[model samples]
Target chain A: AQTVTQSQPEMSVQEAETVTLSCTYDTSENNYYLFWYKQPPSRQMILVIRQEAYKQQNATENRFSVNFQKAAKSFSLKISDSQLGDTAMYFCAFVTSNTDKLIFGTGTRLQVFP
Target chain B: SAVISQKPSRDICQRGTSLTIQCQVDSQVTMMFWYRQQPGQSLTLIATANQGSEATYESGFVIDKFPISRPNLTFSTLTVSNMSPEDSSIYLCSVEVRGAAGNTIYFGEGSWLTVV
Candidate 1:
């Protein structure tokens, strides 16, 4: 069974600053995928970014990037030039190549202050 | 990205009752998924709804408890049978969309269920 762990329960960053959310997972499969999702007060889950295990280059989407260390099973999300709209509960997810299911981490609440 | 909508955005139901939530997508999709998010907890996948096939449920979930229907490529429904207080949570429906990274998933606003 694969399990995702988000160490930080909460995080806050000032506008235009940077913040990083830590996530780790336990899995035996070499081929898999990792994702970061944002859920605002509206309760809509939106994908922030995704990283494939086979790719050595980390995934970056505008102000969001991930530090994916496959050997250590660590995938951290870094948000730069944070804006107030970025304030939300961020979740890290893991998906294996074999199944359509995705295992999610506990989640971290991010507050971007103006 | 696919725009998804869920019906009965929220409802308060008595224990032992059943609630059916509908999920409609703006465009045809390959798959739909039902998930549960308990208070202050991570999202837990309940089942995968595939058109023309019986929904595949995850461990700890069963067809009897959470019956699903995917009549077409753009719509699906999930029913929580014999609901209890423990079942109080937000039920979300999602669709897998094509993206640069292969398949990307998007979710609806979710139907909040409170069983008392």
Candidate 2:
């Protein structure tokens, strides 16, 4: 069984600033994928960024990036130049190569204050 | 990227009733998944729907409670049978699409069911 943990229940960031949301997971599988999903007020789940466990380099998507430390079992999401639209509930997810089922964290409620 | 749509975006049902949610995809897919998101919580996989076969359920889920149907590649349906307050959660339909690195899962808007 695999589990994802998001220690921070809530977080706040000032507009135009940067914010980092922490995430950790426990999985025995070597080949896996990590993802960060954003659910806005509209209740639409949007993919923020994803990182492959085999990749040493972090994944960056415009303003969203991930700091993936495979040895530490840590995958954190960083939002740079944050805007009000970034305010949402962020969830960290894990999926193994064998089974495509996703395991998600509790989520971090992020508020981008102007 | 494929577009997934779920019907009856939301509904209020009485206990002991059943609600069947429909999911349609723009492209053909091999696997379709159903998930449940409780209020203020993360998503949990309910079952995996595959065309031409019975659905595979997760540990805590059973076919009697959540009956799923996948008659083809681009469509599936999930029915919440004998609903209760505990079943009042957001039901989402998802499909995996191949991405640059690997497969990425995309979710529908979700069907919000409120049982009283």
Candidate 3:
């Protein structure tokens, strides 16, 4: 069984600054996928970014990027140029190549203060 | 990316009652999933709805408790049977799309159920 862990329960970032949310997982599969999802107060889950384990380079999408360390099973999400709209609960998820089911971690509630 | 829609965005029901949430996708998908998110918690997979077959439930979930219906590739429904206060949570519908790297899952705006 694969499990994702998000250590931070809540985080706050000033507008125009950057913040990083830490995540770690335990999995035996060599090839898998890591994802960061954002859920606003509206309860709409949005995909932030995705990283493939086979890729050495991390994944970046606009202001959202991931620091993926496969050897340590660590995948952290970084949000740059943060805005008020970034206030949401962020979740780290893992999915193996063989199974499409996503194993999610407890989310981190992020507040972007203006 | 697929556009997914869920009906009865939020509902408050009495205990012992049932609520059925409908999910519709704009495009056909190979896999549809149901999830539950309790207050201040993450998403937990309830079951995988397979077209033309019975839904596969995860551990701690039962078909009788969460009856799912998948009539086609683009539609599914999840009914919470004999609801209780513990069943007050947000139910989400998701779809998986095959991509170059792997399958990318998209979620619909969750249906919030409040059992009073």
2 or 3, greater by lDDT? 3
Off by over 4 Å in 1: B98-100
What's the TM-score of every candidate structure?
0.93, 0.97, 0.98
**lDDT (C-alpha, whole model) for all candidates:** 0.92, 0.93, 0.95
List, residue by residue over B1-116, the lDDT tens digit for candidate 3: 89999988999999999999999999999999999999888899999999999999999999999999999999999999999999999999999988777778899998999999
lDDT of 1 by residue, A65-110 (tens): 9999999999999999999999999999977867767889999999
**Location of the lowest summed lDDT over 10 successive residues in candidate 1 chain A:** A94-103
Candidate 3 at A92: error in angstroms?
Answer: 0.3
Candidate 3: deviation at residue B18, Å?
Answer: 1.1
lDDT, candidate 2, A1-114, per-residue tens: 699999999999999999999999999999998999999977878888888898999999999999999999999999999999999999999889889999999999999999
Give the 10-residue window scoring lowest on summed lDDT in candidate 2 chain B: B97-106
Candidate 1, residue A48: Cα displacement in angstroms equals 0.8
Model 3 CA lDDT for position B51: 97
Cα lDDT for residue A75, candidate 2: 98
Q: Pick the candidate with the highest lDDT.
A: 3
Q: Candidate 1: TM-score?
A: 0.93
Q: For residues A29-66, write the lDDT of model 3, one tens digit per residue.
A: 99888999999999999999988899999999999999
Q: Rank the candidates by lDDT, best first.
A: 3, 2, 1
- Computed on C-alphas against the true complex, the DockQ of each candidate is 0.75, 0.74, 0.83
Q: In model 1, state the lDDT of residue B88.
A: 97
